[model samples]
Target chain A: MRLPNKTCAMGATIARINDGDTVMVGGFGVPGTPMTLIHALVAHGAKNLTIIKNDANEPGMGIDHLLRAGLVKRLITTHLGLNAHAIGLMNAGKIEVEFNAQGILAERIRAGGAGIGAILSDVGIDTELAQGKQIVEVEGKPHLVETALRADVALIHADRADPFGNLGYVATARNFNPVMAMAAKCVIVEAEAVVPLGALPADAVQTPGVFVDHVVALETLTEEYAVVER
Target chain B: MIARAALEIESGMTVNLGIGLPTKVIDHLPSHLEVCLHTENGMSGIGPTLPSDRADRNLIDAGGAYVSTVPGSAFFDSVTSFAMVRSGRLDLTMLGAFEVGANGDLANWKIPGKFSPGVGGGIELAQKARRVVVLTTHTDRAGKPKLKTECSLPLTARGCVARIFTDMAVIDVGPEGFELVETAQGVSSADVAAATGAPLRIPNTALPSF
Candidate 1:
């Protein structure tokens, strides 16, 4: 018995994304962002995308390309402080933006991956972020129910991977990648290096191959993955 | 102000410093201080900010600055990173504020149509840290007071701030509202009181200057 190879061409895998699909992009800043997959997505030309990410990256990078292409219709994110273009679009009503407390967003995605309905949290109970959210009393204390956030596809970046799709992320670059891998129906990964099966040590595997659908090895990293000057 | 705020961070405390002024408090910390600094983007035992030429592209703080990791550093996913915050493993968090009310309410994340960049991890950091202190200028660039009787802007959290370190003074929010703890050098209690939007309560004893 042999483990099947999950590695595929990036373009073909990204083509699985459709119009109006809810996509989860894994990254904090430049570190864990799947720039190759994102560029492939831009070339794939999927429109009306609902993007869930930590930040919008900066202008002329990452999801900003999708935003620039007018491919995204909505964004569910933690903050867009660095992206004035994203803010302008949201303010001008070109795109619908839903903000979440950073931790709550992580928990919601984790819940979705764990097959849970929602998690009750006290993090945003008294703030404007709690507005219109269902309030449930737990142990006589009020908590807001943050619903699980599952997506149609998850775009991931890994520092290393095996042909079996086992992943390893480095440093802070590990941010949303591991969890987002579990929450999507189709998990497509772009790895800096794709090692042979059995090459990745068992304990080093941050995300198991079972959670991933496709792994695309990056031949050359673009400047987008470089350390930001600002 | 940063030096004064850095004093509030005691040894062995787990601290998260918000972006902007609060992040600067790290520079004032003594080299031998035993503190574990956390970043919401997924790291603990955060080291110094790195120069771009020598930076590892993979390592960065929540504010997107390239940084290094200290000894005993650990990295995790966003969920576990925030779990430490919401679960109260964090000892203290210093945040920047747009407005801090007399009652300790914080308004920082949003200013409605004028500025709404969205709240990142600020809500949890403000509400769940064991102690929440603020580092801000005494007034906005327009010379308007930010320490207000009540926040006019949308709040990030209610009654969450414990102490405020501003350019003019170090004030604590108590049952009696903004109590003057220390005045900045060359600034008088009257100057701080006049700059504060809320009433400032001065003690009868001479206040120490930071």
Candidate 2:
């Protein structure tokens, strides 16, 4: 459904993001991560969230705040090496982390958006990652049948968005946001700048407004989260 | 080591340089070489590491190092980036490994209890690239050999690596075994064989020094 007026007040939209939801957050590190929206979720105190993303955003930053608050029941991501707290929690049996090979994970989300059931891959075949998954044989070659991944809601970060919600991503910030936007039931965007309806060039729009549910203009970017710490 | 591996790359190749030692390959490349660097973080035409002053927080490589993009650089989403990889569009992939078996089994992702970044895009790149090469030290910090009869650590992909460029030697993984391609200046053939955890196949002709 179209968002009322194509813009959402943070409080009004966040309230609809209920507890025990599956959230697909877009980012590799801090670039395309919707930090303001993430903090809003933390402030909302939604519990038992299943967060799917590329990284955990290190300790005390982005997603780490949600994890520190014990809000995440499970994390599905490709990398957690940067977040020691997440590693500690997983090792202690306090949280569950499902690791997917980065490419495979993105493809699964794409498959979900395309309404495909599964895609065959040889990525993790015969490895620890293939332990419990089905091994199907295609033309005598064993390929792991990775299922599609869909989320309850997608919280995406965009460099620019029009009032109609067409998103323009910045650099590597475009990584997972476009795909997640297509695979989620509800897609809310945190745009650094929201311009007039026709401001973003049609060809430059990475994610069309059709996939977006709401657009929330960010107040400002916190530089503290921008630096890459080793 | 990276300097030697850079020689293997040809012009017009689409290459994916993995993290660690392989990432250094970019610096040793010829000034006029025209290969396009693809970072699995969804960008092609990767440029050299940007200076901190010129670095944009939003423009970083897959390894989180600030990087610039070439004039023809095209940014895409993760799905398209990986589709290029999984479809074998990459001409070469140079990766770092904890151990690579005689049969080309790569185990670079995890080490028992140590934390790993998960098998990010290593498996796909290794499995689907036209040629898979590894850039690593001959041994671990404690001087234990990383080339193995079989990978004791978790395997990233099966029978994928074609060649290895290490500090001690350049070896090609052949059906017979790890054949010694060339030996480094300070490393003796005997010493290279002894340091290898797996059996080494010596070439009949005199080995060249790199």
Candidate 3:
């Protein structure tokens, strides 16, 4: 069968994902995770990957599948307090973890997406999160310089997408997808529904088509709750 | 403590309630006033918790609890959400504490031998919010005082907390040190002073009720 525009088979897209690549996965809890794409990546067996996300989801869900698959080498996130497996991995020295204050993490990604080098802040100056960071003085006040974070690929889920790749997300599920879409070298979206162009109104489009590289429409969109691995 | 903390919140203000004790403050907010709630997970105008049968699984507060939305609720991405926090748009922030030092230093994220995965948005919310209030008990589970001259646990942010509401008293972090604002009913200034790990100062004026 001939290929259709930007839409590609999951296998072909997952094949392009390489080891040691930094990936930004979108979701807050189980809501907006790109589960089908993640499953495909697991099936493809790519290892030594680094994932930057909001949290290491609860055991047997979301990023935990990748962690269980022994694919993720490093995790840069705000918290993993609820996920025992991620904590166990960190405690066992099986994985490297870098914790950013949640807001700083989001801002750094945004800075990377906007091409800015770094931003200064007083958020973690006295905490472990700022231990070795460069402290710059501005006008007399000291601030920690937080570097921008960009990824090699961003695997995001969208509620709806157009053929041209414009996207829309639902509710709180919209958390990290739009920013991750901007900060990655390749943006692959798992769209529940791929609508015709212009069907997603310009005013409603959260991530413009220009930032998207590929769209893989799910064969059968899994219910949001079913994405919970447990 | 939660009720006392809720009283500090004014009408029509945007507030960020940290995990643990601070989250309970929402239950005590006056019904006549409209208060907007901001969660780091990316939404504002939060309503009360929802029953499981009525909950939309996809919609939840940052704490992972199902929550309803107010009339003006708006959703955005992580970037915009954090921007609102970092830019000082939040009127108040109430957080739980492990230990709060005399100079207003906060240490809430971790303690030795415990698996605290990471510090979430507490850092930014502590530093940027117009006011930072803390909710905690007078002592640890072991009955050891938690309000200290210097934090014994790992610090989350420095000199960020402005006021604290404990089960025993309402205290303010002033330039001189911890000032006893008021005590719980039937609790005395001396009782609060003894409970605090750090020195407690009582102003000359009559202390007001929380």
Q: What is the iRMS for every candidate structure?
A: 0.6, 1.5, 2.2
Flag the better candidate by TM-score, 2 or 3.
Answer: 2
The runs of at least 3 residues in candidate 3 whose Cα sits more than 4 Å from the true structure, single-residue gaps closed, are A1-4, A221-230, B203-210
Tell me the native contact fraction for each prediction.
Answer: 0.93, 0.76, 0.83
Highest-scoring model, lDDT: 1
- Interface RMSD computed for candidate 2 is what? 1.5
Steric clash pairs (candidate 3): none
Q: Summarize candidate 3's per-residue lDDT along B168-189 as a digit string, tens digits.
A: 9999999988999988988888
Candidate 2, true inter-chain contacts retained:
0.76
**What TM-score does candidate 3 reach?**
0.94
The alpha-carbon lDDT assigned to residue A6 of candidate 1 equals 95
Fnat of candidate 3, please?
0.83
Error of 2 at A93 (Å): 1.6
Model 3 error, position A75 (Å): 0.6
- Maximum-DockQ candidate: 1
Off by over 4 Å in 1: none
Scored by CA lDDT, what does every candidate get? Answer: 0.95, 0.89, 0.87
* Quality class of the docking in candidate 1, CAPRI style: high
Q: What's the best-to-worst order under lDDT?
A: 1, 2, 3
**Per-residue alpha-carbon lDDT of model 2 for A82-138, expressed as tens digits?**
788888988888889899989899989999888999899888786889988988999
